[model samples]
Target: MMNKPYVIGIAGSSGSGKTFFLKSFLNHFKSDQVTLISQDDYYIPANTKTREENRLYNFDIPTSINRADFYKDIKQLFEGQTVFREEYTFNNPDLKPQMLEIKPAPILIVEGLFIFHYTEVNELLDYRIFLDADESVALDRRLRRDLIERGYDEEDVMYKWTNHVVPSYQEYLLPHKEECDLVIINNTDDPKVIDEAANKISVELHEKNSTLNII
Candidate 1:
């Protein structure tokens, strides 16, 4: 592992193509050179809370995550240490200890909604990217993903989108966009856009590494 790993933060409103951008970015390099840590996985497990009550929880809010632990893990990874990453089961509350073993790499990426909300996490980022998309486009994508992948119905998706997602974006996520190193408009399903962004990031990383080597 490299002594100093480069960390990238990809943040966006819910369903704004953060995951897609992350996947496309990862495709630019060898699998072993990059590591991914999703903020979605750092959600605190609802232990005694009933399923219905858990459904009412505003997961989009910063308080919904165990931020301290998440930051600790990220810091560990930055220091070239192995971390037991959490595997969040979106709609499934019964699964215990959603953890996975992850090794350190030269490039580390952490993506999610409210990723920049935590001060410590934000300070650790070498590059920050904010993905932007139309609210309607995001809603449509979120509805489809939740219905097919997360086992949510139309009503539940709409309810959460209207109540939790939009409000949280206005309050927590949107304000941080102005501070991002790059603001990518990702309204379309275009590979070229992703490639361009990833290439730019790769160049920035190469330059940083080269400077360190020269020193």
Candidate 2:
């Protein structure tokens, strides 16, 4: 039986279905038992740069994130303290964030492209998950997602994918998968894969609690 909350770090390349898997995983339990902390919420607060400058910003890199704040918030959750959830607008640059209160829970999920890229954040995770997807599939999914959710045009999406997103994944994100305890191959068509992953986590949590009780 562990005394602290169970922290799971889910990391993967863009368009690897990390969001899809997370949503599915969270569906297994009641909302009170779990909380999600997304690294996307910590992106360097709306900068004053121009549209082209913002477009040129390498969001895939570690520097694009305010890691210190992210670490502090997660650490607070670990200490059974409340944190304010930072709301990030996908395509809005000038909008200020709306921070909402987030209560601690038994299971805490930290998901992002660079969840494992920062040493401090990686050390705090009780379990790590890496989602793998084919480059072709990932590219297609990313293109579609950016177009609809992020309001990026085809040319811009392709440019960013080929230039920043893919390169950053190869340089920083992909190698960190070696540190993860579980590697999930995210096939967009398979719901069973998500279901199985959820069950594995549930069983592990139950077993850990049982052991802690015995101890």
Local error of candidate 2 at 24, Å? 1.1
Cα lDDT listed for each candidate: 0.80, 0.81
**lDDT of model 2, residue 191:** 73
lDDT (tens digit, per residue) of candidate 1 on 33-117 = 7888888788887646765676677788888898988888888887779988768887554445546877788788888776788
Reference-based TM-score, model 1: 0.88
TM-score of each: 0.88, 0.89
Angstrom error at residue 209, model 1: 4.1
Residue runs of model 2 more than 4 Å from their true location after superposition? 93-98, 211-215
User: For model 2, which pairs clash?
Assistant: 1-212
Indicate which candidate wins on TM-score.
2
Q: What is the C-alpha RMSD of each candidate to the true structure, in Å?
A: 2.9, 3.0
